[model samples]
Target: MENKTPIIALVDDDKVFQLTASRTIKAAQLTDKILQFENGEDALVFLKNHASDSETLPDYIFLDINMPYVDGWMFLEDYSLFKTKLSKPIEIYMVSSSIDPRDVDRARNNENVRQYIIKPVTREKFIELLGKAAA
Candidate 1:
């Protein structure tokens, strides 16, 4: 990935959302390495390995709340365990198709999560996330 473009880790169980988000992000030209995953479990595995590698980890992660097996919330709980591995707090954004107030409320309280945004992510929001990651 280029140093100029931000890297984003996109975790969602839905294949459609993952593909759409990845396409939209690249279409906006806001990121270079926009990793896609079908579940939070695999995403977490990748995150762990990436953090251990010498290379810099992803600057941002877009997490989906509703998924089979290890959901986004569970991932967050586990992510906290690896908090010490990071030099700074990794920017995480909750992206979901559901509009549940409780889900939004829960995500807001998580210090690692920066935003709780509804899916069908647009160029503007994607760009905004890139700015946050860069900051």
Candidate 2:
């Protein structure tokens, strides 16, 4: 059996958010590795480059809607092209601070999006998400 720890990717530009989210995920024992990306572009690059490698690709991606460049929307558009190329199925959760109903509707309409979560993701939320993913 393959002994690979699940990998989680946080695609956001906020430094403080990344730090806190990483800490919470670690504290919650969600996964062994957490990959941080400053923008969606970087995350997409890594995913594309490692599309054929299940062990190298992230199992889950928490995407933020706003950023300097290649925001979550753009990332979703681009990712749609390469989604089928991935060797492993990756669960994507659109995590944003926006309370806009449009944003929520858009995320929910997307077939690839597993769920949309608000900001300041709590340890309990992490547990629920991770547990559901495992199931």
Worst 10 residues of 2 by lDDT: 1-10
Task: Give lDDT tens digits, candidate 1, residues 1-135.
Answer: 355656678888888887878888888888668778888899888878777653456668899998999999999999999867865456889999889999999999988799999988888888787866666
Task: In model 1, state the lDDT of residue 123.
Answer: 81
Kindly list the per-residue Cα lDDT of model 2 for residues 1-135, writing each as its tens digit. 564567999999999889999999988877759999999999999999999998889999999999878999999999999899999899999999998999999999988899999998998998999888887
RMSD of each: 2.3, 1.3
Go through the candidates in order and give each one's C-alpha lDDT: 0.82, 0.93
Q: Which regions of candidate 1 deviate over 4 angstroms?
A: 1-3, 54-56
Q: lDDT score, residue 26, model 1?
A: 84
Local error of candidate 2 at 70, Å? 0.3
Position 52, candidate 2: lDDT: 99
Q: Residue 8 in model 2: shift from native, Å?
A: 0.1
